[model samples]
Target: MIEAVRVSGLTKTYPARRGSAHVVAAKDVSFSLAEGESLGLVGESGSGKTTVARMLVGLAHPDSGTIVINGRTRERKDHGRSARLRRAKEVQMVFQDPYGSLDRRLSVETALRDVLRWHMPDPAKGTVRARIAELMDYVGLSEKHLGSRPHQLSGGQRQRVAIAKALAVDPAVLVLDEAVSALDVSVQAQILTLLNRIRAETGVSLVFVTHDLAVVGEVTGEILVMYKGEAVEHGATAEVLRRPRHPYTDMLLSSAPGPDWHPERVSELRAAFAGTR
Candidate 1:
């Protein structure tokens, strides 16, 4: 299979605040996604997962290293017409919060229409509505939800709408940044099923960025574990989850509540640590 997205030694740094040192968001990160494959990027906050997501979707440029998509490497100066258009059409992102990512002012139909118009403009105008409906169906949404605004829909419905919008561009790569973290557990499962279905039906490569190991295990075949702005461990999802090689990865897995685990025990311990603060 052809590689859909490739990153080698990807690095990013932010300028320091008044009294702080420079912030390194990504450090020598390297990975590759095959066409139609789903890879999970797992880590805690400030682990560079979101930074990698942003760079993958062209929202941020790396300070050094390379990002190759569909055989073309993205350079800092490639923000020209052709590059921008290609990036928009071939790569897309689904953010963590559907409410924040979507426009409350626009109806679901209008939001979808705007994306289709921008990315798939060559389609006949008369066929756009049908295409929109098809996309809605693909994401398990219906026409009734189209007239509703983001605020009017349930969390799952709003996320489904967001997925539809991302698919509007017929993108080859989908960067999902904490795509289901805000939804209820059941809703998260539904969204995961929907995403898996979409991947199976459309053969689009997926980069799922999240802090949840269980969620990642459910959907992704490969896993990359990040820590301190770098990838500490990476391998098959099952392998990594079952036999983590890094200390950070082990800590994350250990922290999750297991079948025989007592949640209250940890809560009490944490509370005691706080010392009535």
Candidate 2:
């Protein structure tokens, strides 16, 4: 399989704050994403899920690790302009808070235009506008929204705009950090469906970071369970869901919200995950 993303021994630490000792946000973590495949990163809050996701997109620098995207390995030691551009093309991130990520001043069309203009200069105005319109359509938006700002749209619409912005970059992979968690359940489902369709159509690999296991089931084929800054278990999402090997994985699965959850599933999960470690 062609590897779109290969992460190994990834680690990050922050200096002591509030008289506390230095904190390790990620341990020697390792995972891989095949080209056109989606992987779920399931974990609790403070489990370093976002830390790992942020590192993939250069939001948070890793203390030590290898991040190879689309056959290009990013040298953490290098801070050159060409390297940054290469990494940007390899992966883009859709943050949890769509409203916060979008510029308050930029309208829907202008926001996309800025990215296209910066990335590809000398394009005729007609070309830029046509591409921007295409992007809006791809994300299920209409040209009527072209003049609207972030605050003017609904939560789901804003998120769709965020997706459009990410797609505008034409990245090979998308590192989504709780991209749909903030919206209502119906809206979340809509976003997930859109993402699955987008992946099928574009063949862009995805690293979906979220605490919700059921949501993981909805979108990913493989799953990695993280706890306390470490990846404790990983395998087929269905296998892990039906037979979690790590106690932490079992706990997360049992605690996850479901549309038809019953108390008995918890006992079943515990027994299935038990003694399998």
Please name the candidate that would achieve the greatest TM-score relative to the true structure.
Answer: 1
Kindly report which residue stretches of model 1 are placed more than 4 angstroms away from their true locations once superposed: 262-277
lDDT digits (tens) for residues 174-255 of candidate 2: 9888988899999999999999999989999989999988789999989988877899998999899999877878677666
Least accurate stretch of 10 residues (summed lDDT) in model 1?
268-277
lDDT of 1 at 55: 93
Q: For residue 21, what is the lDDT in candidate 2?
A: 92
Q: Model 1, range 1-277, lDDT digits (tens) per residue?
A: 9899999999999999998999999999999999889999999899899999999989999999999889988878986777887897779999888876689999998998887777666887677899889988888888899899998999889889988888888888999999999999999999999889888888899999999999999999999999879998999999999998776776677668888566666566555534632
TM-score of each: 0.92, 0.91
Pairs that clash in candidate 1: none
